[model samples]
Target: MFDVPLMKKNGSLFAGIALLLGAFAGNARAEEMSLQQAVEIALQNNAELQAFRDEKGLREAGRIRAGLLPNPSLEVSLESGALTGNSGENAFSVGVSQEFLLAGKREKRVALAQKELEVYRWQLTDRERLLRLDAKSRFYQVLLAVRKLKLTEGAIELNRHLYQVAKERLAAGDIPELELNLVQVELARSEGARSAALEGLLASRAELSLLLGGKEVEPALPTGSLEAGGAVKQAQAELLRLAQERRPDLMALRAEAEKGSAELSLAKAEGIPNLTAGLGLKRDTTAVEVAGLEGKDTSYTVGLTLSMPIPLFDKNQPGLRESSARRDSAGNRLAAAASRVEREVAAAYASLSNAEQVLSLYFRNIMPQMEENLKLTREAYQLGEVPVLTVFEEQKKYLEVNQGYLDALYQRQLALFKLEAAAAVELTGGVQ
Candidate 1:
């Protein structure tokens, strides 16, 4: 006859071994990556950075075109009296004219183009700064997701163990059926939370892969703990100063305002009139009554012509007005950018301070106490001094405490990132 209980135990052992082996295989397949390595990959492969670089190249081409002089024009004319039997009275003329810009117009145009190119370079710098910030944010988000998933798994496993204990106690008539049913319900809830956490982890990884530019990336695990990051080291006043000096967006706007000033100067210079000079050659085959010359004789003449516009009615007044208005607009925008940077630096600094305080509270008091309480509750249940429900409650509390600590850690890191981005400088050494 079959030993039914022994067979069931052996089946459970085999199932546990299978799950362990699967976990080991999965771990073996994952690659380990640090946050710095992730940012480096994003910098190399990000599509938006490539687009910005291409735009800079386009601006360079435009700058070169702006430096070139205008093209010279050619003119030609022919006249004949063949129908009136005066074929000898034929004349042909050809001329070449070149318009020369006055009032240093060419130099002004080239200078404006140079300023525009500088603006583009500054724009590229700002784009890189923003993209780097986004990449770092995504990297930390993945780390948080991984931590949450692990926490959920731990909670689920603990619940499963407690549920098994409850079943054993009920079978031995040490606990009521209601107690076992409650543990069963808690186990189901833990399992559902784990499922939701897994979905979240998957979504976070997908977003990270997109930021990395393509689908060819390897599956990698974040190597560090959430507790590794530190708070910002600089004061808000110092950070605001750094923002004014180093922030790429602010610099780009400054360049824009300078370019606008250059444009206004160029517009004013356009009011000056240009000089047009022409050289001409004429040939006529004719006989004059005062000259005893044959009709076959050829007469040649050369001419020089100089022309200038009166500039009496319109002298680029509209262009000057438009450029002046744009220059004013640019100045206003730059002032606004400076104000916004100040506000952001102050806000980020405050958030970092609060996060540091919360994290300190968790590390010093809450987490340790929850862990100790869980251990004591488990011991009391074993000694028959406490019910299974007490152990379950303590374990749930411990999980929540750990979750809160992770949240605080993430918040601190996020605030640090925002502060660094706003200040346009590095304030700490590691993890950031």
Candidate 2:
């Protein structure tokens, strides 16, 4: 009987544990989606990236078709001649000829086409990275706006409580009417601020949706360890290395320069003359003393014929110079981009340091003092040592710290993104 009762009790206990575990797992799933998932979805469906893909495909097709040999020409002729020999005699000839390229011009064309293919491929990579960065920037904007709206709502709630307290105090003749009115006015202002921030948050969300392949996909609000989230700890050398190795814009510049080099090669090869070889078939009739009336004769001739373009009028020197200039311009652009990237890295680093310092002040110094003052003023008011207005002032100070903290978070994230855009690397939390 004891074993039976214990077994039933154990079953109920196990069931209770199972229910708690299930609820916890369900909450975890509903709360957050990692940034990596968002980035992957954007990449697969992003419209701008898809456009680059199409552009690259077009370039590849053009390169392939460009390698083919030039088509040969066909020639046909009809001639009539009369040679008088005592009486009247006539001779007629008809012939057809076909020509084929004898020069190795096709091989030279193939070389130039291979070079062009490299340029377009790099251009495609550069556009893809820009699109990814754009998406990340917009996503952060939405996050920042939402954070601000929450801060505003929190402020409004604090003001509402203060207003209620002021009303009670004024009715009891403990506080003046003007003090109560001041709290009411502050409450109204907080409400207005919250409404405006809510509108801005919605607008930011809409902007993010447009960039996400023109579709709206709502993301769950994210929360992280804010202490280290604002740390932009990447070294300058690391950023420079990433810029050199993976930056899409720089790669595009290099690709264009290579394409220019290919163009130069083609221009030089154009100076070489192309030769065409021909073969012909002919028939001669009415040969004197050798053939009778209605005699049929067939003659075939195999000859090496060369037809080449004259290099006398144009030597392609001007074209060669233009291509060289383009190559030089591309190099200059690449250098400028490198310098600009370094400057951007420096600027972002400075901003990050400043934001971190300010954030520290609010977290470590301002918030602590504000919270202590609020408690002290409230206790004093209850003891008839301080007025209700004093407590309300302390409460407003705390709300100000909250707003400042939210603003600092937004600024820090923006600085990080600017650094990422310069280094051409994906942010740690911005993969999606």
Candidate 3:
């Protein structure tokens, strides 16, 4: 005889253990983070961004070096006439000299360095702007993957329920064994799809984690919808104007042009040779023989000297030409960057407009019809009013349509990211 109470007790104990394990697993899962938080983390900890930021320190050091004055030179000398048999005839001298910069060379150097630093700052800002776009793009990719996984899971559940119903109909002699086999095959397909979707989700999460500077083992769950938040209301003209005014890369190019001009001026100033001024004190001693005694006479003297190069051969001709060419190049580059920005903004704007239209169509027309058809087909299959193949076709169609909508949503988000990057302005207010 079986011990009924003992078996019931054992079953309850096993269920309690399973529930506890589930709770522990849920607790161990990483917390969900918002898009803004994700962006902030990336900005703070991303390795590439941090390395770019380190370059600012180098520019700052250059500025420091440019403002500093040259050190003064010191000269000391001793002259002894002992070798020439004049032991008391000796001279000692000390002098200090400074090279004074002419044509405002030091000031011009400082100006050029300051302008270069400004260019670097603008370049760093441009890098940060691109990083924000990248983070947002990756965040949306993870969101799309999550939705795909969920869709696959739902498909698996639906197929499993249909398979169970088909088995019952086969036993009741209302459906053939072939129908049950078909449902079984569809369920297996759904399972395979779910496995692929899970793999995709994991890959997307890993990519997101790397972007956010998080360890690969600690990927945070993204908490947001894939729905298009709002339509881009800005006109192309307005976006172009914004890009011209606010784009950091354009600003950097303009700064570079100014820096080149400063450099040319510095080179011109450098062609003027600096004047070196020296001040010195000297002492001289002499031996005098009078009667039978030797006496020493000493004299002290002060002198000043000034010297400068004639600049006959090297007048920094090469430097001047190089700076001039660089200035012209910078100007041309700025113009080209502006043109590229215009094209990018136009292209992104058109893409976003098209994506919005497609997403709207799916939302208003296609998806509702797809859901209704899937529901009706499922009901008809359960009632034996439709063949198994009809239900399978409808389910597959529903899954395909939903996946297409998800893709549309993902594409629209990508278009928004590109537009924001091109225009160098925030269209949607989030972590920007």
Candidate 4:
């Protein structure tokens, strides 16, 4: 005869072993990382961000080049009359000349380069801002997956415990085979759900690893929650003001507009032709015949010369026109960017407001009531005052309600992230 109590104990032991094995297999090499740590890692290691940082060197080089003086040119010439049988009659000259930039062209070029560097700096900051937002979003997704996996594990345990109860009752002839069969079915379903949840967790972890620039042999486990932070009491007007002052992309555009102005000044300066000044030493040797006497005469002279372009037809008209057009275009772009910032701030604020209300409703009403109902239903089931189907239905309801609550939490957190990114300001504390 099969001993029901011994068989039940063995089944419980086997289930425990299987769960432990599954856990070990899933997280064999997992390393726990916090949300802040993940964001830091991404900022430090992201290939694209590093590439943007390298561009600062090029901008700095341009600034250096703008401040440099042109190299002086050296000229040497010799003239001989050897073909005319007068080798002694020769002339040689050596000269050096430097073309000096006029009308503050060099200063304006340096200013333009500096403005360009400022623009690049702001652009790099904007990239970092966006990268932080992406990392936070991906981290929250991993956290949500972790929560689901735990929820499924809890459900499995609950169903397994009830399965044992049903089995004991069946052995004592206190319940029908149909009731035991129903508990068995619920247990199996919970186990299957756990498998799916685990897969979801793995997928989320893989995505996070890629973002963090990690070639992880096993995915890093995220350590964070989707709990709501303090409420954002600031109005949309305040947020928009903050965005105008803090948004890096907006600042980048402003810098670019300033750069265009500097370029226009440079183009106007360039219309003034540079002056090239030269100093030279000349030596002349001539054979003279006076009163039938042959003699040599040598003379040396030093001369200074200045030269410049006529600027008759090309007074940099094309350059000036291009610079003026660019300046106007930059101004228009800045205005358009400001309008877009207003729109983004308004949209993010609306989403955050809606998410906060939904999350509050779940916390203040649905979650507590669902927990209480589930507790009562389980008690009634154990006391034989309710059918297994009633317990099963209540358990399913608890899972569904909790899942909905988790979704609410995730949405609320995501909305908060988007709001912060749009505003380019931290409204509340970091992720909870």
Candidate 5:
């Protein structure tokens, strides 16, 4: 897959303004779109994928041209005068000649061209697949930014309410001025966080817009569940195997090397001789006058001429050397591609494993514990057995856990994307 580098934070802010335009319109217009439909639109319209499709057409054209034989040439010669018994006479003769290729050059070229076309076809397919996955990844990032915005917004509102309560308590001499200041500080922090999240959401939407190759994408997120299809452990081996079979970039490199090999062979074969043979009918005024020779009665001449290029100064020596070097270079690139793919797949699996474990922990232990602790602390504070400060601390911890849960969920989904990219296969059946 082609690399989509991470956006620099400060630089991203300016770039993302266009991303928030739709959201602004949505706020003003109350219209938004679902994520799945957005992904479908992106896949259908992404400019990069469309460009690759154009490239595929060129490769196919090359294949068609390669299958054709060399065109024959017509030759003409004229003698101004032919002396017969001191009589001035002139005759012109015309013939056609064609050179047959030696050492199966045409077939080899067609084979190489066919391979090139196949290589391009796979590259196009791979790009389409990556574009779809990229759109989804960007979608999740936008959602995460929105989700974080909501959390911060909630936190700010709660802190503002608590600050008012503390103000009342201080007025009644129930709490110190320092406690009210602390609540005000918390409220300020929450508001700052909300602004930061809003900025991130804007930037994320812009990045997503670039991926979609358009400005029509919106920030309203879909809330449906992502079904994790197969067990993570089972999918690991499956991904590795599929990558070996289906990694198109690697296959393209191999095809390129094979094409170079064929070029080298063609260069070596260039020194070989080819048969230039032709058949022709000839008619002259003298022949017509002497023997009543007409078009059909003209005598036929058939012969073969052997032609070859000498190994003097330039006997395809440079071409062979260049082709051989390129073939070797392509072979090295293929080797590197295989190594990189292996590492990429392994790293993706490791990340998937760790992310799954993290999500499981958040789901089975941390969130439940945080929720239970918050419930008990709320009860205690209501009974006046514990101070409201303890209940507030639990409340903060519960919110943090909720944020962590969202982080785990998005991280796992991103890991799944990476794994499929490395493997170059739909190991999860289809992306959600």
Candidate 6:
């Protein structure tokens, strides 16, 4: 006896342990990720976003530096006796001087820095939004590629079976050799398609990984469907208004304009020359013989000095003109940005509408009809009532129509993302 009952018990325990380990591995590989997680990862790890953060830090440093006062200067000097005279004397003096701003130049400079910091803040936000769009687009592309690969693989399997059936019919003299050759050609084409789909899927995954700021990422399926959703209900006018109010780039441009104005004010204030004041102390000592007795004398002296430039030249006129030009430029740029936003929003809306219409045509009319035709043609071909070529053509037509529908779905989602980008707000999920 081999301890049959004890052997079964140990086998059962080992099987259960293996299954548990497999389940854990499966869970680890799947790593269910949502669109929000993808965007968050990009924001956290993206190199460009990191650079923007550093730039923001620099702007903050500028603000701190602008609010500080000018440093005082120390002056020291030593002098000795005249060249020819025997009256040897030595004296030393030390002074401290500070330049005081005449107007509110310090305040103006600080205000300018503040405005620049605000601009950088908005720019960072804009950059994050753009990266989110990129990540979402790449994520959806991976999903599309995976779906395409599945579709091609299925087609390849079906075609292979059909080719085998055709070969059997030819050997039995029930189908012509021409039909078998055509089926073989279709099988070859399907295999090629499968290869292309596999390549595309790999490329798409790589792109998504790059966007996620990873050197490489595990091959995981996107957790979503490409189902179409409700149409955009907001009026175009309302969308344009929202874009104007919310777009981060527009806000940044406005901030830049304010900064320019502040800079101009600073330039004007700087034209008022600063006053420099100095204070010093000196000690003098003397030795003399008075009535045959040696006597010593010491004295201390205090001196004050004040000075200012006459502003006759370099009165900051050029700086004023430059700042004025920049302000005007910023105004023009703001107007252009508004127009660009309007155009982008209108274009995206139109594209979304067109994609939705095309999708409706395919799903409501074309797809059902194509599927029915393929089913009927395949049945007829098996009954020897129709040729194999007819069935093959129907299959091809079905594949083409479905592929077109997939493209339309992707376009709709992409248009929605573009609209969000233009409006500088969250619109909808990339895929349904």
For each of the candidates, give the backbone clash count. 0, 3, 0, 0, 0, 0
Give Cα-based local distance difference scores for all models: 0.78, 0.63, 0.83, 0.82, 0.69, 0.76
Q: Candidate 2's residue-wise lDDT over 273-363, tens digit each?
A: 6566665554444334445544334354444465777889888789789888988898899889878777877787788778878877877
Model 3 lDDT at residue 374: 84
- Top of the candidates by TM-score: 3
Local accuracy of candidate 5 as per-residue lDDT tens digits, 403-422: 87778778888888788778
Q: Which ten residues in a row have the lowest lDDT in candidate 1?
A: 1-10
Q: Name the top lDDT candidate.
A: 3
The order by descending TM-score is 3, 1, 6, 4, 2, 5
Model 5 Cα displacement at 116 (Å)?
Answer: 0.8
Question: Mind giving the per-residue lDDT tens digits that candidate 1 earns over 1-432?
Answer: 111111233333323323432354453345656777887888888888887787877788878887888788899999887888887688899999999988898989888889889888888777777777888788788767767766776787777777777787788888899988988898899889977876776677668778877665545544455666654567789889888998888888999999999999999889988999999999988745546655466789999999999999989999999999999999999999999999999998899899999988987878767777877787677666898777877887787788788788889888888888888886764212
| Tens digits of per-residue lDDT for model 4, 300-370 | 99999999999999999999999999999999999999999999999999998998888778778877777
Question: Per lDDT, what order, best first?
Answer: 3, 4, 1, 6, 5, 2
Give candidate 4's whole-model lDDT: 0.82
In angstroms, what RMSD does candidate 4 have relative to the true structure? 6.4
- Which of candidates 3 and 4 is the stronger one according to TM-score? 3
Candidate 6 Cα errors over 4 Å, as ranges: 1-30, 82-87, 216-220, 285-297, 428-432
Candidate 2 stretches greater than 4 Å from native: 1-33, 79-108, 216-234, 286-303, 377-397, 427-432
Per-candidate Cα RMSD to the true structure, in Å, reads 7.0, 9.6, 7.6, 6.4, 8.2, 8.6
lDDT of 5 at 36: 65
